[model samples]
Target: NITTDTLTIAGAGLISTAMSGDTLTISTTATADQNLWATFNADTGTTTANTTTDTLTVSGGTGISTSITGDILTITTPALLNVVEDGTPVLGGNLDVGASSLVKSTNVILSFSSGGEAAVNWTDISTALTGSGPIIRSVGADTNVDLVLDTKGTGDIDVSTNKIVNVVNPTANQDAATKNYVDTTTATTAQGTLADTALQNIVEDGSPQLGAQLDVAGNGLGDGTNLLLDFVEDASAVNHIEIENEATGSGPIIRAVGADTNIDLKLTPKGTGAISVADATNYETNVTADDDIPNKKFCDDTYAPLHDTINAQTGTTYTLVLTDDGKLVTMNNASANTLTIPTDASVAFPIGTRIDVMMIGVGVTTVTGDTGVTGCARLAEQGILIGRR
Candidate 1:
């Protein structure tokens, strides 16, 4: 049995009455003013009714509650003094809203309108704030973002203060010769090199006089001296030695009067005595009695058989009186002209005729046999006839 506050039943011209039971029941007949309420401990109270229609009002307190029986209920929450539309509100440690679904605010739901059709729709929250017009970004500050005008493929990247460095357009018929590099700061212009006939003609000299001193001298960097010729000998080694001809008859005569044109041999004695054709010369001698046997060898130490044969035509004779390597002396009588001896006189001469042509210190003295004849000969001992015929 709960007791409520007093009912202020004010009826005009009718008696308000209640049924006698454990629960009080009041009835309003017509145009009757009856209020059933409960007073709380601090002017905060609850009004509950057994019927479905419950009207409750509160003023100047923290909160109020009421119970009614309809599915459609109108809840009036106070307009918050400090309102943040989509802010989270906490009651101690629990969330005051959205225990079931994510609660979106009216601004969020209005922006979620897809073009124009609007129910409460969910949309993606952009992290950017909008201005009145279109959004813009700077090319330098925008990382990983590409502008629409960028080229399609990858190209070489370089730093450029001027225009972009590209493969300089190949000139007309451009090749390595036609392409050139220039330094613009110095204002130097480089004309491209080309291989043309005219270009070659500008510098080419086909037959150059090489080894000209102008070509090899004086371009710096090394030592240069022109030391070029000077090496061997020739035919005119001696001046006047005529050994070419003998038949000219102008050659020197042997042991005769006007034949002393060259050197002659006349024997002289070592001891002072008559040293003619007779001397004990420790050698052999030969004599022949003939009127034409011109005063030739009378006695000689060379002991040659042909010592008496000084009249041989163009032949050499020798008398081995002394060897040049031993204690030997030699005397030579040479003929210049070719001797014309008869052939029978050469056949009468013997091989071992003991007539001398050389001696150790003396010369020839006498002649014995006939003078021989020959064409060309060598003297094995030491006398002389004609040199050669």
Candidate 2:
């Protein structure tokens, strides 16, 4: 049972006490530090009657500090940062160190690691930093390692106008060669002055001229086996001689060809040597044209006749053939007999061909001409003689 004036509160700046008919009430006052003290008292609310007084302590951690004056508590924080040694600190903004260098020890190497991969050390090669600039090269101990410069996606490594010098002489087919190596090797090998002269003579000269005697050692001049060696005129397209080598089981051929249909390939022998064929057995058989050559057997049987051999014709009608030239024909028929003379197109008797005809029987034999036979009036009138003049 407490009256309005029965309850008393000594800390008037922090709290206020009031009584209403048998109940008591304690409340926080409106002050600057009211919220701080209210939270502190609420955290330590368990208290008994006549208990020991509780002390509210405010301490600092790392870069923070706390202080207490007459009735106020002060928490002091540092202006600079002091991070823990073992913790990873993430900065939301840029960390700029003004006018100071970030230094590392000589033995410590800077590396890059990404995507949970092992870190690779930077600048493994030793560089000479004096003179013009640094010469990027391999280190002393790593003699076998190669220095490769790779480009990113479709990018090219351009050297601009500079040349890569001091290259070694190439031994492989695909290796790069230096200008000095090419000049030195060409001068000493077979491709020297003589080859240059030969190539220049062939390409620059208009006439057919040779610097030296042409020698076909093993290979031929034209296209290889079974090809033609054509000798052409400079202006004429149709006039040429094609000398062709035959394939297996055939002889070689030399033919004259031109726009004229009939052309002759004449071989005039030097110094009275006769035009002779080496193969005597395989002679030219089909002798039809005027320029055709007759073999020995055909000349002996057809043209050169035996004077004493007489061809006795017992039939009534007899025709003169090519074999009848330079021979005597005797007609022996009981009835009147007729001896026919053929045209030059059928039998092709040579000029000055003579055939002697005699009437043996009592029948009077008369010589006649075929349809196209001309200049045979004397022979057609008299059957005693038949000649082609």
lDDT value, residue 179 of candidate 2: 71
lDDT of 1 by residue, 185-235 (tens): 212123223322111222456533322234445543222332122212244
Best by TM-score: 2
Query: Candidate 1: how large is its RMSD?
Result: 33.3
- How far does residue 196 in candidate 2 sit from its true spot (Å)? 3.4
Would you estimate the TM-scores of all the predictions? 0.13, 0.32
Model 1, residue 77: displacement in angstroms? 9.1
lDDT tens string, model 2, 1-389? 64555446443443555667755555553433333434634332222222244445679998788888998988888665566553557788987879974444432232222324452322332333356433444332344645567899999888898887778889999877887655455343333544343334335557645545668898686776565588877684676688988779998899898887888788889998987755544444555678877777556655565444578999989898888877888888778888888887878888767677777777778777889764333222224653534
Model 2 weakest lDDT span, ten residues long: 42-51
Q: What TM-score does prediction 2 earn?
A: 0.32
lDDT per model, in order? 0.34, 0.63
